[model samples]
Target: MNVRSARGAAARLAGRKGEIWAAIWLMARGYRILGFRLKTPQAEIDLLAKRGPILAVVEVKRRASLGAALEAVGHDQRQRLRRAGVTLAARRPSLAGASVRLDLMALAPGKLPRHIPDAWKGE
Candidate 1:
């Protein structure tokens, strides 16, 4: 494999690890994982979770810093995730009546995962 492909693979692996950690962290905090790497036409949701009546649409990022991880999701990405969440809820009967929330799970080395709820709301 070329250098670019190898780097891409490594990044993907790290992202998968981050998603797993994020899911575990959420579960520990009373959230139940519904899906992982859920691909819709509009976007890919890193993790889907639920706690009570809230359906959390999570975007997981592993960056050098928690702030960088939070900033990694930009305007366009947020829009896509919003659309994707709507589409997912419309198609999934089980998600009916649950409030959809966009969440960001930031993972950095030597630190616990940071979860930001309603991350892009009113932004």
Candidate 2:
């Protein structure tokens, strides 16, 4: 429709593509994708993955550059994602005994998806 709306739609499409790419990359590295685009009342997690006894809540960001993507998820966002990961673990019986952590996947044009595991500090 409008230019702004069209740009927003395109951005969303690009973000979804980035997420799918990140998931595939993770799978190749032995991580099994459990979920994506999970939204709750408190927060939203872009992707959930498992590798052995580790369950990761991944935040996917696609931007003009890798640095831009990495900076997209700030301190507040990390805290929210951490909280969501905890909530996800608590609500899922299957994730019991698994260590839950926060991860980040940064994607940019002509670049590979960068997966940063346990990028946030938690108590």
Q: Return the top candidate by lDDT.
A: 1
In candidate 1, stretches whose alpha carbon ends up further than 4 angstroms from where it belongs are none
For candidate 2, write residues 2-101 as lDDT tens digits: 9999999998998788889999999999999999999976678899999999999999987777678767888878888888888888889998888888
Cα RMSD (angstroms) for every candidate in the order listed: 1.1, 1.5
lDDT of 2: 0.86
Taking all chains together, the TM-score of candidate 2 against the true structure is 0.92
Q: What is the TM-score of each candidate against the true structure?
A: 0.94, 0.92
State each model's CA lDDT, in order: 0.91, 0.86
Clashing pairs in 2: none
* lDDT for 7 (candidate 2): 100
The TM-score obtained by model 1 is 0.94
